[model samples]
Target: MTVLSDTSIKKAVLSGELSILPFHDDALQPASYDMRLYWKILISPMRHENGRTVDLRKEPNHTFFVEPGRFVGILTEEKISLPLSMVGRFGLRSEFTRHGLVAFGGIQIDPGFKGRLAISLFHAGPELIPLKLGRKMFTVEFNQLADQASKGYDGPFQNQSTFHKMQKDFILNAHTTSLAEINTLPSEIASIQHRLTMHETFYHPKREFPSISELAKAQGVSPINDITELSGLLSEEDDIDTFLETVQKWRRGNNNDE
Candidate 1:
């Protein structure tokens, strides 16, 4: 089996023997094509727990932070199609390895395989590693088979293009268990309800507000309750400071009249 060179790969792509959707000519390397990270990822959860799927595109900067010793499964941005005479394999880009990230998937691509590649990444560095969307993270190399296989690969993960949770039932159960625990704490719920009730009672707008006549009676002054008077005073002022001074003078006159 001979590994395909850049020229051969280009020829195969043009001849319809291979297809790379959303291809970029600049991403083609000497003997391989660079593959970019997709927006979706599967985060490996804690021990005895179920993993969760996250879409990095929905995150800030379209990025995800993976702590040291954490593992994540990511998908490739490009969709690939291989004919019966060709197989593909992928490896981590040198830049990622330099940052102490280990990529462990795409060891083999069977003949006639077609789909986006799923990459398993582990952060082996002492510091957290940030994986960004649309970054070139892996290199895919194609190989020509000696002969076409008798049968093509049609396994369960054959056309897996999106991130999927492996233990979906466990995630559902964990969510249900959390709700059950919260429901059993009636005292805590009651305490929260009481606090909310007290806050509502204290801050009721209608109860806290006093009418202009009531305020004037309390201060022993005549109420300047006419809207037309206030509007005329405001219209006569050229600036905010003048308007404020006029209002203050009006208040002082009311206090003097009392």
Candidate 2:
């Protein structure tokens, strides 16, 4: 498979061959853009005899809380009709990962697979990164397959329109269970840990807590709400840390105390 070049990315967007998400304030670069999660998601209430139990279409008003500094998988509303002769898969934008966010699934593309995309996102940072609805999180980069493979992902998730959590079998495995015993596990696990810790040190710094009343007034919202509620379920220590840093930066009071 050949990766899509920057020019190809632009051409695809212009030709409607690829869907371009809403541009966020932080999404200008020479290469790729970002995408955001929808407000609601469908969660399975219980496991039934077969995997065909819960359907997202059946539930309309279902809500899933997307806490700041966390991850969620969402389905894009747009659909792609790939010609049978061509095949492609999505690639995660590296900038998002640098910002302590995840945008990759299994990184697999099936031949003859035609449908919308399901994006998986995870934030390993401490600070709350606010995301607005319809904002871009990552751009889709397509690769051309030399020859279309026999198997494609056409069964369950095709033409999916809503965000739903993956099945239980998807996450739990030898990787999740016994780590030390696996021969190849130590280096891979260590590498992931190293990257995560490094990201926390650099990008996910603590933030200062804004005064709830002040924040409410500034945002032109209600003041009676809990400060935490207004803060979107993010860790409070991050805010406090930011506040402390800002205070230290401007500790020299010129005329206020006089």
Give me the candidate number with maximum lDDT.
1
Q: Candidate 1's residue-wise lDDT over 1-258, tens digit each?
A: 989988888888899999998888878888999989998777766445666777887989998887655577778899998998988888889988998788764488888788888767767766667889999987999999999888888965677786444433332233212222444589889989999998988887356678788888998997567767666544544688855677787877853431
lDDT of 2 by residue, 89-124 (tens): 555555556656566475554555555567655555
Model 2 regions lying over 4 Å from their true place: 6-71, 149-152, 164-258
lDDT of the structure predicted as candidate 1: 0.76
Tell me how candidate 2 scores on lDDT. 0.50
57 Cα displacement, candidate 1 (Å): 1.5
Give the RMSD in angstroms, all C-alphas superposed, for model 1. Answer: 18.4
The deviation in Å at residue 32 for candidate 1 is 0.5
- CA lDDT of every candidate: 0.76, 0.50
Q: Compute each candidate's TM-score over C-alphas.
A: 0.61, 0.42
Runs of candidate 1 with Cα error greater than 4 angstroms are: 46-51, 164-258
